[model samples]
Target: MSAPPFIHLRLHSEYSVTEGIVRLQDAVARAVSYRMPALALTDLSNLFGLVKFYSYARNNGIKPLLGSDVTIANEADPDRPYRLVLLCRSLQGYRQLCDLLSRAYLAPRVRGRAEITRRMLREVGVDGLIALSGAGAGDIGEALLQGNRVQAASRARFWEALFAGAFYLEVQRYGQAQQELLVSETAALAAEMDLPLVATHPVQFLERGDFKAHEARVCIAEGYMLGDPRRPRPYTEEQYFKSGEEMAELFADLPAALENSVEIARRCNLQITLGKSYLPDFPTPAGVTLADFLRQEARVGLERRLQQLFPDEPARARQRAPYDERLQLETDTIIQMGFPGYFLIVADFINWAKRNGCPVGPGRGSGAGSVVAYALGITDLDPLRYALLFERFLNPERVSMPDFDIDFCQDNRWRVIEYVRQKYGAAAVSQIVTFGTMSSRAVLRDVGRVLDLPYNFCDQISKLIPVEANRPLSLAKAIAAEPQLKARIDEEEEVRELFDLAARLEDLTRNVGMHAGGVLIAPGKLTDFCPVYSADGGGSVVSQFDKDDVEKIGLVKFDFLGLRNLT
Candidate 1:
């Protein structure tokens, strides 16, 4: 009915590793319902949701504020970590944010949560970034609550000097106890220091009632039972996405904070270019372009293959011109499309695996249709003999990444990954992170337990859920397909309640897992493109972005597939 009063400037959309429960799509829907013009994603220690959040926000008629709730190294005490909310004001700001987050993982230190030191931050330099005096639990706010106002003021001033005019004192009122006290003290300090103020909602879920399901998510993440106060329980029900009016009323006395959020949203101007193909460069010899090198290699390999495949001179002669013509045609298409590097890169790894006695498949999928692949030893198929279409592999019309699903010997795939890391620099390569969303049956078990329903009861209801042949059906679809599930829902009230809650909690992120074979390689250290994360601070380093978004932002994905049947 009226102009939106405020915009949410701090939100964690499941990309906060284990802590966030809101999916980016659902968060956007909630923001749309609030009729707000802008929203922000400040996922902890990573920008995993940045590309998708930004793209989706724009598509949904909202300005997306880019920020992170990064865990920073406490310079005075390295053992203790402090969290800060950093938001970007421009393209330069986004780059700085990426560099800062990248160094957090790249630092030569013992593995733990990814963190960058103040010294590292200074080296990277905060140019277009806006620093927030992280409201409650932020360095400044926590220092105030801990009765270390001197430290709080020092920290605030340090950020103010670093951020220059781009800094603001972040005030949030999420119905927490010490929030008002922190806000009052921080506001007076900001006035004394001439720092601006901005209000944030710090959302974790779409609605307040989703807290129980969110709690189940936390328990599922940390291996804790509900009410297990000994473990980390950092969020409250108030962390839900509040309406702009609700937030404005919460900080009614300090409208300046609310207005400043709008100002910050206005300053943030990010333009993400989607659907562009970004492949990693494969190093060629001096004075040789990848296109030229690939052409030379494929031609020689094809000639040698023809001699071997057809031992008779007359038979080989018959195959020669057609094979050469097909090879030239495919090569032209690849070179014209700017994908010679992609072909060369795939060939190198496959050849590496084959040389080391690791079984490499001839080729699978549409890639089998290319004669150039047969020449390069990337595939064994003779496209001419099979009458396979070259357009299926590298179409002149299709504009997408030419995905070569290379299957390596099941056990030796790790060696290939390690080789890539060593050659490309460990920081340049990372396995893609895949999220495990709470599925229909899964939510029934999780929410059922949280609601203190018996295990047998939960299991019985879950078993009634149908499993389709190709893809699993949704709860609604399953209920429609299975009469037993419908009958149970109609007969028992507890069953109806469980189904109700499970349906609501379904599709929220439950856990993080490594993608089966998807690995991302960058031209430089990956943090320049996207942040990397780990399962327990070490071991397999995974790209924070998933399969689709990983490609959307321009990091090339190479699926190093492993199949026993291929061998």
Candidate 2:
């Protein structure tokens, strides 16, 4: 039988943050191009690309190995740090890895340095996990480079004991002289210790030609002059993904290294399954179901609101026949739609906000069209009085989430979030994460900085391109818009080069930040349902999913958007 295809145990994508330039989709495409069966994404320190990687790989008929390049404390001296690459071989292993990574960042420690401890690994590391000694800067490589072969071997022995045959000595050759020597030494040590040696390229780019652009990115990140020969740069262009024949040729002297890669792929059998929402159980008062309680409260509240609005009306005149019928219909609709708890949850905090003197707006969007919301105090506007249709707010004919775009005083919005956190357990509530992409203008600026182009020349060229807020300007569009730009591209090689690199990098997510008022609340612990990230100030947990993806994963997003006008 033909041997299983080689698996790339160590690969990085654009999610690696300036270090790697291959987008996740392009990476999968490249792997498929080579007819590779599976690949692993060990992006630096975070599984930011995990879900996307998994979905793309699976859809493209390639298996995705879920892993992360985590910084771990040095064994001999817990102060020094080095990265260790861990891959999940089973569902439990994936969960264990998530827990380890979560604790590594969430626990109190030094500001910038986040490292997982040996104690954490022992406690949380599950069975069916494959451990790889990371590339040149990894723990074992650092030890070996320091000429401490015994220490490196000792660490290997410890990992072998912890993970048994699941631990492999990961050796990478990126054409660096040091990496060449380290790989040879590591392979020898693995053989001596009866451990397998796996070969990897430490892939950061998809093609050799991408090296220059990737290097420019590195310079931008390190705040260094690209032309300066003194700046530390990546060892070589050999860091791009290579074919199986290329890997075989590179490790021809030690065939087992290439063979071990296939073996590792055969051994790893894990897949990350997207989970359902874990919405918290909305507490019901004594002798009343959540649905019943919501209806009772909304009805009583609506009557009081009508009385306050028309206090001078006689009782006979106040007995409007339609008011009670509308209330009953809205209440029945809300309960039947399985959203009584959702409405109550939204109303509770809104009420709390107003009571505490926090300014709340009348309403915005179709949510203002709900009479029940006006009754429950979820909104200040009267739908009946304003001639707003309830169907527009809660379309029974077309089922959709009841969205209330609440506007709160910007200054006191956090008070509302704090109240929600207090009412629901802290683990149940969190902000949604959003990413910022490098747009056409921004990418032009980045490339110009790296190419060392004159500031005014770059600014003038950028200004020539017409600005479109929603639609970014393409190189072709820019050429069409400005005759001078086309002339510069045709005449100057450097100008062309800047545009070429910028075009490639544009629209790539450059950084991540929290969404302003999009909070997701679950019925159970969020970590059980989805991954959570601690906010910058360590104040709140943020879901890794964006607004739309959060809904796809079954968590409804309630946008308690803060508006300055509310103040």
Clashes of 1: 0
Error of 1 at 438 (Å): 1.3
- Candidate 1: pairs in clash: none
- How many clashing residue pairs appear in each of the predictions shown? 0, 5
Model 2: per-residue lDDT, tens digit, 1-567?
342346788887777675777899998998888888888998876677787888899999998888888888775766667778888888777777777776676765544655778888898765757888775667778778888989888878888888877887888777776867798788778878888888877888888988887887777667776788889865489988888778877778778878878777777788554544334577888789988998888888888778876776786256545667778888888888777888888888888988999998888888888878888898888777778888888867777778889989999998898888888788778888887777777778888987889888788777777778766587678788888889999999988998888877777767777898899887776665556666443556678667766775667788878898776
RMSD of model 2 against the true structure:
2.9
lDDT values for all models: 0.82, 0.78
Model 2 Cα shift for residue 202 (angstroms): 1.7
Measured by TM-score, the strongest candidate is 1
Quick one: how many clashes does candidate 2 have?
5
Which segments of model 1 are wrong by more than 4 Å?
75-80, 105-112, 227-234, 470-472, 490-493, 565-567
